[model samples]
Target: MHRFNAYRIFEKEGQVSARLVELGIDDLDPGEVLIRNSHSSVNYKDALAATGTGRVVRRFPVIGGVDVAGVVVTSGDTRFWEGEAVLVTGYGMGVEHDGGYAEYSRVPADWVVPLPLEMSSADAMAIGTAGFTAALAIMRMEQNGLKPANGPVVVVGASGGVGSVAVDLLAGLGYEVTAISGKDDQHEYMRHLGASQVLSRHTLEMGKKPLEKTIWAGAVDPVGGEMLAWLTRTMKQDGTIASCGLAAGIELHTTVMPFILRGISLLGIDSVQCPMALRRSVWERLASDMRPRHLKEMTRTIHFEQLPETFDALLKGAVKGRVVVEIQA
Candidate 1:
């Protein structure tokens, strides 16, 4: 195709603007693989980048999508071949590089992951980077000695994409899950995702002590800040906390008592710049047993034209679960 539709973000008058535009292949950044992108998904980071609400995009005039899955149309790398199913996520995508909110994406070979046999492009995107991060969190927690027999796993921000997937994966793995969210309406939705119990965000009151009740054996925290501090205090001895996003806030004001006295581990999860070997392993797990059973139910698919409106919803915290963007018919 000589030209295709893409959602481009541009900086003008010191303000960022985004729109659907027509662009040619040459407009894409030089890369080894040219993918006919079928689906991409909106993460919290994508919303930040698209709306310029945060310093998510370092460079101007980039596509705003962190996750992409499609068919490889051309390949300069020996490991990838034409017509092979593949995906690209993270590693400066939609930030410093042109991303997946388009009909086509040309990205570096190192950033491309061959889609697993059990996963379709749409399915891969349905999970997307959000799910990938959730899986990575679980993997790291497990490596740190967390197990189904340990106790309960609490998922903060449990109504969002990453949180919902974390709930499902942890429950599917035989761990009891307590989902915590600020949205009152999402209680039933979180339960359906296999959360044994759903708690309001307010229920996790900030205790003024260095340590609180040891309730959680592990936690998948995307809503950092005070919530993370709370988790750190309430975790069981030797428990692990996989900290991801900062939907609540970024600051963590807490004493070192939990880490020193309880030996609790705080694992930082960064989907971007995650090593390829671990990335492949995580994707493979997501395509298999760790995949959310309610994958389709947990996702909302929209076209590329709907991104502007969707970005607003995502930024305002109105969108729930995953928002998958269909890049092709």
Candidate 2:
């Protein structure tokens, strides 16, 4: 029972608080596989759970992180073995169980995926849950007949982790990308990620009609609320919009004209409980043809000690792109 460091969150008297502490393997929730965590990433969901901003944590005094990449220390399941590189995202990692904000993570073997070939632990964490969600959105869109030739794609909240990765992945796949963000400072960064157009959130007019003049052929909408309603109104016939996050607000107010007249598809991406088969397929695609071209540029690695403060910036929408935590280092 080796002692390792973990960041645990607690709820006391209707307040949420978290602090780093040391624990043995027996202290963690039971699982078949043990991972020596090398890297993890800070995502929006992780921020919410850690800070109690969204009340996502199901259990108190649990380690807080939704993404983990590491080497297998031991496994009861035959699918994995010692020294194998692996990663886990979603499937109740941070909320329902002790998570990756630790030097070691013991998780159900069914929840793990072998790290893709040629993908290092650092690279896997850089993608993490954010990139996985973005990729899942695109996967569904393509299944609905979305292609680069369909027309330009628009990504809302384009300066954040999922948005940045979506922009890069879409552009890499030859789709013209239009990025929309409120941060003027991020426009150039979006352009660098291969966006053909960057629209400021402040200047755009969200028309009030059930159906406005069609613009986008597809949309990666992480921001809900008014922005999502606008997309539903403005999508072209047969267009598909992948609704991933509710960062702007969860309430979507719109008419049925877009669905009836235009035949639009609103795909809800649930990365948390994604089927293990599709999850593995998506991870393979992420490491291969769909790999993000700007991962290094869009990501910065932070030491494990810097984890707690990163959540505040994330929740405030001040952080840009991805923040990978070097847990082992």
* Candidate 2 residue-wise lDDT, 1-329, digit = tens: 76989999999998998888999999988899999999999999999998899999998889999999999999999999999999999988889899999999999999999999879999999999999999999999999999999998999999999999999999999999999998988899999999999999999999788899999999999889999999999999999999999999999999999999999999999999999999999999999999999999999989767877899999888999999999885
Candidate 2 least-lDDT 10 residues: 301-310
Count of clashing residue pairs in every prediction: 0, 0
Model 2 alpha-carbon drift over 4 Å, by segment: none
Which of the numbered candidates is closest to the native, going by highest lDDT?
A: 2
Model 1, which residues run further than 4 Å from truth?
none
Candidate 1, residue 98: how far the Cα is off, in Å: 0.6
lDDT of candidates 1 onward, in order: 0.92, 0.94
Q: For candidate 1, lDDT tens digit of each residue in 88-114?
A: 999988999999998899999999999
Candidate 1's TM-score reads 0.99
